[model samples]
Target: MFDAVRNNRKIVQIFLVLICLPFALWGVDSYVHGGGAGEDPASVGDTKITAQQFQQAWRQQQDRLRQALGANYKSEEANTPEARLAVLNSLIDQRLLALEANQARLGVSDEALRNFIARIPSLQENGAFSMARYEAALSAQGLSQPQFEAQLRQDLTLQQLVGAVGESSLVAKSSTDAIMRIEAEERQASEFRFPAAQYSAQASVDAAAVKKFYDENARLFQTPERARAEYVVLSQEALLAQVKVADEEVKAWYDGHKDRYQSAEERRASHILLLDKDKDPAKTKAAAEAILREVQAQPAKFAEIARSRSQDPGSANKGGDLGFFARGMMVKAFDDAAFKLKDGEVSGVVQSEFGYHIIKLTGIHPGKQRSLEEVRPEIVAELKRQASAKRFAEAAEAFSNMVYEQADSLKPAAERFGLKVETSGWLAKAPKPQDLPAYGVLGEPKLLKALFADDAVKNKRNTDAIEIAPNTLVAARVVEYQPAAARPLTEVSAQIESGLKLREAAAQAKKAGEAKLAELQKGGEDKLAWSATKTFSRLQPLPAPPAAARAVFQAPVGKLPAFVGVTLDNGDYALYRVAKVSQPEAIDEARRKAVEREYSTLLAQEDFAAYLAALRARTKVEINQKALEASDR
Candidate 1:
């Protein structure tokens, strides 16, 4: 279950973002301004951090945190003083390093910046950078070309500094070999189970004792407040049904975007490849000729031969089929050969950078223009989308204005936009996945903020229209409010009783274990009298109990009479009076080699940290401590 989620798209995306955003400092703008932002946040090089600067940096950090966490974002946690202080400190540290980097004249060239920007996926379409798209995206994000470039440059600079450190760190063969050795080795062992009931003849807790224990820790049985709320949602999707596209508009759209309806010529082919690299040209020629003869002899079995003998791992599984690709997408020689061959025709082995190939033309598709009549429906839908977007925007603006002007009942605003003013029954401040009727729109930050606003809260008025996402808008009002209250004992009697029993049992166990340990310390050692508990190494399976193995290896090491108490998984406690502690010696040479590889990786990590520290030393940095602290304020 855990591994499945780890590979989920959202989880993987979050993991990559977390890895790249922080400690790695892999984002943009770390370099151009300076090597790093600064050495420390509060007092970098004797400069007091200013509140304004700290707030700005803190906001940016908050944005990064939000981006990284996505749906799991906790507004309160991010807005807290501790989080603000942490962000401020990071900003100061970056400033210090960036200043030092500048002093050392560590800069990125303009060409590098251009290349970096060009490579960004967001700015590309159809495998080529789109200037129009690049501009539109920057505009949407409210960033100018120069501003974006400068930030990118700064980011590149910081990366270079970090990369420099990583590159200098060498991975020793001895280390890698040790690691490889362990990876190639395996261990075999047997295990046994010693269940609690099997080990202890009688272990019980009385009802009276359970009740007493529950009285002492009653809070454990209490439940957090829960609520069911109602809301009204408005979004572009809601308005989509209201939009209409005329037939004339569809026809005009199709005529203007005719290129979109054109189909390019496509060809399907298979090949057998031969390579000239690392072998004599004459020898390669001989092998190609031999293979060609064999293919010619059994022309129908070319695919089977390619599947078994082709050197191209990428396409071999599909019998060396390149699928259908249009002209200009492949290398000149390969493209020419495939396009010239008729369906079912085979060509002699062709050579390219990867290798030589026996080409077989399987199918061909001729280029053709699509008629407007054939694509009219699609064009109409597109026109409707454009029209709908404009209409929705206008409706959204009107909705916003109506709420702002009225600032009272949602009835007025809702009537104006023909949207219902929805009300929630009650809602807790704790973040939750939207589950209310009108929550689709009300869950947005803007709507939530408005609902909590003094005007809305005091008058109990509806919130203004808020955009949750493109085209979606929502308006909501809180019908009733409830402050959190402690749950009554009667409401949680069963829970309390269960918790009480667990506590009483744990207490009893701990008392018995403690007395047993005291006796052992004095002279309870009668080898046969001592109790035995099975233990396992890290990553090893435990005996039948289904318990984790980490605890076994983490237990204290000593002879009999030494006791260490640890809480059991079931909330009970156990004291292990050490009879024996097994020491796991290092693995043999084969395993040792694998360990070495890991040790080298560890060394590289250390070296990288050291490099960052050095870069910090070289930068001339200053931080406004006062400003940073003010971020929390």
Candidate 2:
């Protein structure tokens, strides 16, 4: 039922990915920080990294991974010492950037901050910013608008500092051309195989060898424990469909929140901004007035003039179009000038905090009241969600108690909460995150651990209900269990013997291939039979085994018929004859441009890394081991 600002609102997303992938954090040297209110996981200079700070950052990273990977997210994997260290390091990097930015007196403007927040997809509704949705999102995250705005401002300031550092990075023309030449060179080659299978007859493993190898590698022959389980999930989504919202409630909500449903009067405007860089405001105003006269004489050419003359980086490229915005969204002078103009009318020269502006009003959307019928479905859904949340909270405790009190069956809790008890196929004791999707919600680590626990597996009991997600609780019972066991030596003897023989055969093949390669390099004639020739380069490569292809590409092309050999993991040895080398007739212009962009990006990444390392070297850091280890919560 809540809707506001019906306009095509676009934000200039001022994001610059100048650093390395994932993150590039500052290095730290440890010291001690005493007399703190509580334990700190880490500290940068005088600033302490609180447990709450570390955990929040960790949770945000985990949430991003979960959204990006969907069902493949592993909570346990992220809650590791390594991940915690990375998270703490990122926070330190951010702090360093903030410190540098503050000292540099860098700042983000009101318009930039509003537009940046507007660009957040979750805070938007129907392709526009919604005040109610923004409020709700902040509430859900336990953040106030001021708190969020402060963090956002700090982030934008960091962007400014880092973007400057990254954009300053330069790539040499010679470097780019050299890399292009190296990648463009192609070599024609044919393979000569020294097959390990040919040497298998001479390779042997006696009883003493097999017994010793088998004894040392006992775990290799053992099978991991597996289980099949039945589980039930209790979540707000499960309760939402069942919790009905009455027509009366929907109508009452719409009537009470009519003010929230009023679409705002938004104006679309384009402007040409002129900055007084040399502290000469009078000159800047005169220049803006001249542009204003030109714009007034020919309103149709306002965008064209703005594109060439406007100094605003945020909007000049788009012909100075700031999209549609409500009143008071801009600075006071700019706002008044923009809203006063009629569609297709150009405004007189206006002065604002940024600079002088010549404004042109392009479009207008008038304020309108939304009808009750139009917002009924939205009101119903909101009411349903509210009711579901309250009901879910009450049922969650009962669900947990029933699963533990009864301790034998999940049916009591399932039937009481109207949830279905789903069964899974064989589940591993410690399944890889990629394999967890097969088990559904039972893939949750805590539930899986409970399913295979001694009490549950030995005495057929239901697991204690665990909150797997925000509002999702799960309890599972082990239906079938398989304990970890090793295969008998008698059963594995043949397999062991074959493995030993194959390994020895591979060693022999490698030795022979390398000897031949050495001889060929010394100008000795090879009587070896070669296979059909095929061409390859760095860009276009061979299939199947990649190690052999890598060896070929990396081999020197100084002499004709140069030789290179590689031992295969599967017990085969290959020697390649580098017969010919040639370059393409013409290098594609588009591919050259792509490489230029990639090389520039690489330079930017390295520059940013060096900058961070410099900051870390000067800044003192202290890490509390006990607090860090206890932060698994």
Candidate 3:
């Protein structure tokens, strides 16, 4: 089917039109019919949006979001009601555009479609179209070349309507100039903040008020529901503690796999390196050749020459010694030259990416097989791990069934498996996910949820065995359950008093700041120390809360030193004195052009939306709300 679609463009184009008859892309059959045979997710005019089409679009949207968020993507972030509605609305818009294009008899030329595909940045390499890259991109999306082109043609036809509507949009030069001037304007201001702490001494809370607040919001003082549990864990590590490997078994395994104990040969070498510092490769090569000749003449003084002349600071300090390393550890040219030289023998000038080098072979550690005594501990450990893993695999199914069939206590399973019945401290009904790590196996989300189930908490029944990790199972039962209760009034009174004082202090600070602002606005005389005046703009604002910065820009500038007040996010009141306002003297032509482009694009989008709205009004659309919501599940 894929080969045939790739071979015939006309046949693929026809196939594309026929395949989307009952989907978001409208066909002649859909344009004449109201809906498909079965109930559909939505319908724009007479075209039905099929469930399969909705699912495909939904999955595509999911992929786009995952790619955008990268590692930050969360499973629960998708499939929200708002996300589903956005997808459905997108499908409706596509259906509307397809219907309009069909009615207008719009079409894209074959050459035009080919040009669009070739110009795609992903399909190009070295600034030229690459057939291999284009084919791989299509293959990644499970699309054939002809099928992709057919779809591209339909999209290009719809773009014609978009272009027609956008061409009708007109942006005014006056509006662009006014917005540009506003953006370029700057304001100077001085700030004075009234800290909430200054009013703390004056805030006196009455005993009656504190009691009333405590009574009204008692839930805040209640203790959470928690339980203590007795649990048993069946894991490979737990089984490994019981596994003992015999000396005979270790000997047999080591003898059978002696090749695994062979250690690769390692070489230790020293080198003097010279790098091309002045972008003159010939000068560096000459310097390296001179050093090589010096070392060759005085063989015993190689270390002395290397220390004085080598440019590699790391190895030069230690007489140009590079510690022992196995093959393939260093650059290819350097590694080959170092290994080819005999002990204490120096090589001629060798060139690598770094520049030039002279290498000396110092020591060689040949490959060798280990004796039985040297690797006995390692062999014993490997044998025990293998035995434990096999034992755990066989016991896991029986463990799961035993816990469920017993269903009363973890004792039966623990005794049968020679495991300990561990006890937990108080655990909340729903502990924070991050805090679960301290509980070990009990921290696993699935196991924790199971342990806190109502049946386990109230009835004191063992939870069904849950796989907490690979080859690890856990079953727990509540030994002591604590119902939700309230802490005593006396125990929480001090906390309530501290909170009440802070709230009252913030209120008093705001009241005082407002009075000072009112007096200043009335042109009254007052002395308030202000921070150094700073000039700021919408593009570059003062280092303060957004509300404080906004107060500076929003103050009236008719009079010098106008005052404005705002309560900040941290519960402090701030007042600003607007000293001066100014705008740029000359217009920047490049900046003007950029702003004009942005303003024109906004106008074009508005015009296109209006045209789409006019078309939607003339068409009949129906949506299945129930089916749309059900699809999320």
Q: What TM-score does model 2 achieve against the real structure?
A: 0.68
The runs of at least 3 residues in candidate 3 whose Cα sits more than 4 Å from the true structure, single-residue gaps closed, are 1-38, 65-74, 121-140, 166-168, 222-452, 459-486, 605-612
Report the C-alpha lDDT of model 3 over 101-210, residue by residue, as the tens digit.
88888888888887888789877632335576777788997878777777667766766766676666576888888988888888888889899899999999988888
* Sequence-dependent TM-score of model 1: 0.58
Candidates in order, TM-scores: namely 0.58, 0.68, 0.61
Q: Which run of 10 residues does model 2 get worst, by summed lDDT?
A: 1-10
How many residue pairs clash in each candidate at the backbone level? 63, 0, 0
Question: Which regions of candidate 1 deviate over 4 angstroms?
Answer: 1-229, 246-248, 265-365, 371-377, 404-408, 411-425, 432-446, 487-502, 517-535, 541-551, 556-565, 574-594, 607-621, 625-633
**Per-residue lDDT of model 2, residues 407-448, tens digit only:** 989998888888898988999998876897777888778788
| C-alpha-based local distance difference test score of model 1 | 0.59
Clashing pairs in 3: none
Model 1: weakest 10-residue lDDT segment is 186-195
lDDT of each: 0.59, 0.79, 0.79
Task: For candidate 2, give the lDDT.
Answer: 0.79
